[model samples]
Target: MTQTTLTSVQFVKSLYEAFAQGDVPTVVGAMDEDIEWYEAEGNPWHPGHAFVGSQQVVENVFARLAQEFEDFRIDCRRFLADGDTVVVEARYSATRHRATGKPLDVQAAHVWDLRNGKLVRFQQYVDTRRLADVMGVSNY
Candidate 1:
């Protein structure tokens, strides 16, 4: 991992792939060992509340998302990189229902912090309105 820059477009690609696949080992392989991954609290769509660190990322974010959602998908549409920062625009599609496989499309964006060729911090932007509805929130 030291041979590659973590904040690069490729890093984001790998990160999303690992996350989309829910491959905890692969995702952890790319982490900085002291990485911090954040998600908003009380997000209706997510399996649960906000989380911090790589450990939480796998257990709370990745594993829970996969376990809760029947089929999860992430499509990275756009990406831009500068120095040790990367911005990615993506279309995230998934099915929260465990039985019928219906898609919920939500536009997403993320700002990543890279240091020493490893992902240090990450902040994500998402279409919360649509996502909230998908999570069965009628009055969002």
Candidate 2:
């Protein structure tokens, strides 16, 4: 039997599907050991630096999101791929902010870089002001 590898777009789409199904392990499992994940610069989740490694991304970004939002979802609108890079245009929606009880709906884009079928780098782009407003964060 031959093992079929996913294309960059397929790999990224699979990660989003996994995330939508609440499969954190599968999402994190696809990342390269030294992956560098960056949240949008002005987004509330940004830590002023990239989250290095799967563990750091899971701990700082995923875990915090799980704890902070209710019914959060990513609705992917399009996927564009070229070489090892894949870009996803999407929207983020959450029923409510856990702490502030505010609803969230915002457009987002994600850039994924893969090497040898392993996700090596990720960068996020989103409406920071909208995100900040929903989170009741004034300083974004």
Candidate 3:
């Protein structure tokens, strides 16, 4: 049996779909071995450093998200691809913040860089103040 590899845009879309279904293994499987994942600067998960490799991302980002938010979802609005880079404009919605009980609805952009069809790097851009407010964290 021959497996067909997905294009960059299709690969990114598949990742989102997997994430929506709570399929963390599938999402992590698409990442490059040395993948670098960055949360927005003011995001509570941003520890002044990048989460290198799939294990770190799963441990630090995905796990924390599951622990901190209720009914969290990513609504991808648009996907733009340029060679090895793909940009997704999306909105994040959560029923409530686990710590603060605040509802969350925020727009965000995700920039993904792929190398030979493997996701190599991810940079997230989001409304830090709103996220902070929902998480009951001081943005300043």
- Which scores greater on lDDT, model 2 or model 3? 3
lDDT (Cα, 0-100) at 125 in candidate 1: 77
Q: What's the true lDDT of residue 50 in model 2?
A: 92
lDDT per residue for candidate 1 within 7-64, as digits (tens), equals 3887778767777676667767777777766564335535454355678777776776
Query: After superposition, which runs of candidate 3 have C-alpha atoms over 4 Å from their true positions?
Result: 1-4
Instruction: Give all TM-scores, in the order shown.
Output: 0.79, 0.95, 0.95
Q: Rank candidates by lDDT, best first.
A: 3, 2, 1
How far residue 6's Cα lies from its native spot in candidate 1, in Å, is 8.0
Go through the candidates in order and give the clash count of each.
0, 0, 0
Whole-model lDDT per candidate: 0.70, 0.89, 0.90
Given candidate 3, what's the lDDT at residue 38? 96
**lDDT pick, better of 1 and 3:** 3
Candidate 2 per-residue C-alpha lDDT over 1-140 given as tens digits, one digit per residue, 9 for 90 to 100: 00027777777888888899999988888888999999999998898999999999988988888899999999999999988999999999999999999998999999998887688899999999999999999994
